[model samples]
Structure formats: structure tokens, C-alpha cells
Target: MNEPRSTYPFIARGASAELFDMGGGQALKLFRDSVSDEMIAREADASAHAAACGVPTAAATGQRIWDGRRGIIYPRLEGATLMDWISRNPMRAGWALDRMGEIHAVMHRVDGGTLRSLKQVLATDIAYGPAPDALQRAAIAYLETLPGGDALTHGDFHLGNVMMTPHGMMVIDWSKAAAGHPAADAVRSEMLMRFGIGPSDWVTNLWRDWAARRLRRSHAAASGVSTRDIDAWRPVVALAWLRARDATGRTPAFMRYLDGALKQAGLPFTG
Candidate 1:
């Protein structure tokens, strides 16, 4: 395949992809060369699945290869992200969160079909993470004990991934979409809201805690999923996040949360 050489200025960039302006209100999500073809196909399939299931999301135009890079084209919706909306209307943060919960619930109702398993993903991350062998074994064992579900999980669902267009809200970024229990998905979302902020201080930590709690409560209420269900996945999600950070050699205060979660789950952690 010929390398994609375009003068179209990049409008945005993420961890693994760059959004290039495609004329006529469209954008190309060009991924890094490191991304595998399977990963690209998985994302494209998930995006289409979400749309077919009645979830609000941008439709993938088609998969393309340029310069050995892969990407999907999608319409460029005009609106602010949920985060930007909340920033512009701080007093309506609760409303924004509630909307987020509603969208998540809708997503979880969809059947996962041929999507990848969330449990398997967790197991893989645990195996590769810096956790001690004992902890890794215990985690994988605990994961086996959990019940399975066919719900379509937006593995990386968060306020930022939601966009508020004039037509309605549109979800983006299906890279982590998976087939699994909704509770696990909810837990992951809550964890990201709680600890994904960079370089946290006391005040920031307090604020994050407050926001995370509200977000969790809002999601639980809207989705009719119990707090217990979501909490059950907390340890697993925390370990995954810790492992990701470890992979990058960054030790953040959130490691304490992972330790606490493991203890709460009755897992022995020497590290």
C-alpha cells in the first residue's frame, strides 16, 4: 500500500492515532504503524456494532492503509466534548454526568457478538504487568470466578470520549471495545475518572475522589446496576491500570489504590 501523504492538517491526536482533516466534514483516524491489522479491524467492527445497536456513534467510512499505517474515516461532528461542555457549564456537571450514564447504559444493553473478551484482556495485562507472580496468579484465578455476560462494553468509556453534537451525543474511540460484564466496564470507567489525572496533589486528589464518586453513583443509578456489581471489578481494574503505569516506569500515587484494592479482594501482594 502506498504511504498516505496528505497536507491535511492534523486536527487532533491521541495515544495511538491522529485525526486528519478530510474535506467535507470528515476526519481520518490514522493510527501509528505499531498498531496491528487485527486491532484496526476490531475497532472498525466495534464502531459499526455500536451504531447497529442504536448507540450514538460516528460511523466508520471504511478501513484504509497508507504508508503501512491503518485508519478509519469518520464524519467530523461539530460540538464540544462532554468534558469541554462541563468546563463551559460547570454548574451543569451533574447533568453532563447523568447524560454520560445514560449513554453508557444504552451501550451495555447491546449484544457483544464477536467482540473480544474483557476477561482475556485483563488476564493478558496481568500476566505482562509488574505484579508479583503470586498476585498475578491470584488475579487470574479471581477473574475466572466472575460471572460472564454478553453486554457490549465500551472498554474505555468516559466523559471525554463523548461528544455533544447539535444532533445529539456521539461516542468515539472504539479501540478498547470488548465483550464482557457491564460491571467491569463501569468499574474501569470509574477508575479512569478517579486516577487518570496526571500529577495529582492533595486538593486535586480530593476533587477527583469527589468527582469519581458522583460519576459512579450517577452511572449506577441510570444503568440500574448495583454499586456492589461495579465494586466487585475494582481490584481487577486497578491492577490493570497499575500494570499499564508500570509498563511506562511511572510510579504514581494511584498505586496505593491498587494495593488497597488487592487487599480488599483478599489477594496477597508482596510488591
Candidate 2:
């Protein structure tokens, strides 16, 4: 692991990165060595774009190096994540799901100009993934058949990414933001909600499934989009997610979920 610079104290840690309290209401998001400079730039640009489009987001101050690791400076806001709220107040999970839908609706209405293409990203993932060449070609072909649009899609939208702040609910992590069909974005959320990485008890899985369905309904209503449309992208989204999890070499269960999703989409499973 790369050592964190002493300028800030450790705040939290995630699978791929670490957060440090930088004082002055700011935080440093130091990334692992595997993260490339280009990836960081893409995330920064996407964050700026989301903020400009009226989506609540952390204020990205600038980028700096900490102990030879690349990091971004952000104004750390006070609030619990939607996931935290759900876990603490299970009875009110419905409310949290509704809020998620409302916020996501606001995002889909905006045009994602010149940011990045969701199609291209999926195509690249498939090409580089462990799947056989035939499966990769089929997935890419399926992606091409989908309708295109200019809507802003948070490529990794899920409960954990939405931070409920004093101001309001704000989004974090713009590494996967892209311009494409809203259904593509919606399907990605569904997949993550249904089968995320990490261990979980049966009860937790049940609650997650319920919450995921609620989220889908609420998002469809708020955005005036149909679940049928979002569901159509399920297969392609699953394949792309499989490539992501495979790269991490974790979440074997999630990999299985993707395989099932692929089969459901009428594509051959290549796990």
C-alpha cells in the first residue's frame, strides 16, 4: 500500500482507495497505484459536469500528490449515506428509495455533452475482460442495438454513492459518469443494488432485493421512464459489470449474477 502523506489524518477506507481528513472541511481522496492519471482526470471532469448540471456533489478543489500517490481535494460535507440511513432506519427504507429516485430523475434530465460515451466504455470493458472473443463481440453488438440519447448517466449509481448532506442529498464518485441512454444508467443501478460485492446474510440479501425493486419503480416514476426500457439493458449492463468485478478478482457471487443476467438477455454466458 502507498503511504498516506502526513498532511492529513486517515478518515476512512474503501476497497480501492482511502480518504483522509484534510482539515478546513476538506478531504483528500488518495488512490491506489493501479489508478491511472487519466482515470482521475475523467472523474474530476465528470464531477464538475454533474455540479454544473445541478446535481448536488462534493466541491472538488484540486488534485495533489500525497506520498507519491495521486489524490483529489474535496470539501468534505457532513451527512450519512443513503445506505447508512437505510441501515439505521429500516422502517423508513421506502422513503430513502423514493429520495434516490427523485435525485436520479434530476440527473437524467440533463445533457451529458462531450463527457464520455457509455457505449464505448462498455465496449472497451468487454474487449479487455476475461470473456471469450465471441461473447465479447455479442455483448458489443447488443450494446449497439440500444437506442442512443444525450442524457447524463451516472455509470455507478447506487445507494452508497448518494450522500445525504446538510444542504441536501449529494452524489460522490464520478469516475464512471457518462453520456448515454438513461436506461443504461438505470439498469446499472439495478444490478448493483441486487448484487453488490461483499458478504451478506440471507436477511440482508432479501432487504437489498426489496430495496432494489423499490428503487427501480421510484426511478421509473420520477423520470417518466418505464422499467421495461431499463430492463432491456440488463444483459449488457451485467456483462460490463462482470468485466469490472473480474478485473478486481473479487465478488465471485456478483460474477455469477452477471452470468445469469447474460443468459436472461439471451446471450450465451461466458463466465
Which candidate has the highest lDDT of all? 2
Q: Model 1: clashing residue pairs?
A: 3-67
Off by over 4 Å in 1: 1-4, 197-199, 246-252
lDDT of 1: 0.80
Residues forming the 10-long window of minimal summed lDDT in candidate 2: 242-251
lDDT against the true structure, each candidate: 0.80, 0.80
Give the count of colliding residue pairs in each prediction: 1, 0
Q: 93-123, model 1: which lDDT tens digit per residue? A: 7777777887888898899999999989888
Q: Which residue pairs come into collision in candidate 2?
A: none
Residue 238 displacement (Å), model 1:
1.3
TM-scores for all predictions: 0.91, 0.89
The sequence of per-residue lDDT tens digits that candidate 2 reaches over residues 1-271 is 8557486778777765798988988988988888878878877878888888798887578998878888999888788888887778888889889888888889999899887888888888878877788989988998898887788888878887998888878888888888988888888887778777533677777877787789888989989888568766877877776566532323565667767778877788856
The candidate 1 region of ten consecutive residues with least summed lDDT is 245-254
Which residue runs of candidate 2 sit more than 4 Å off their true CA positions?
A: 246-266, 269-271
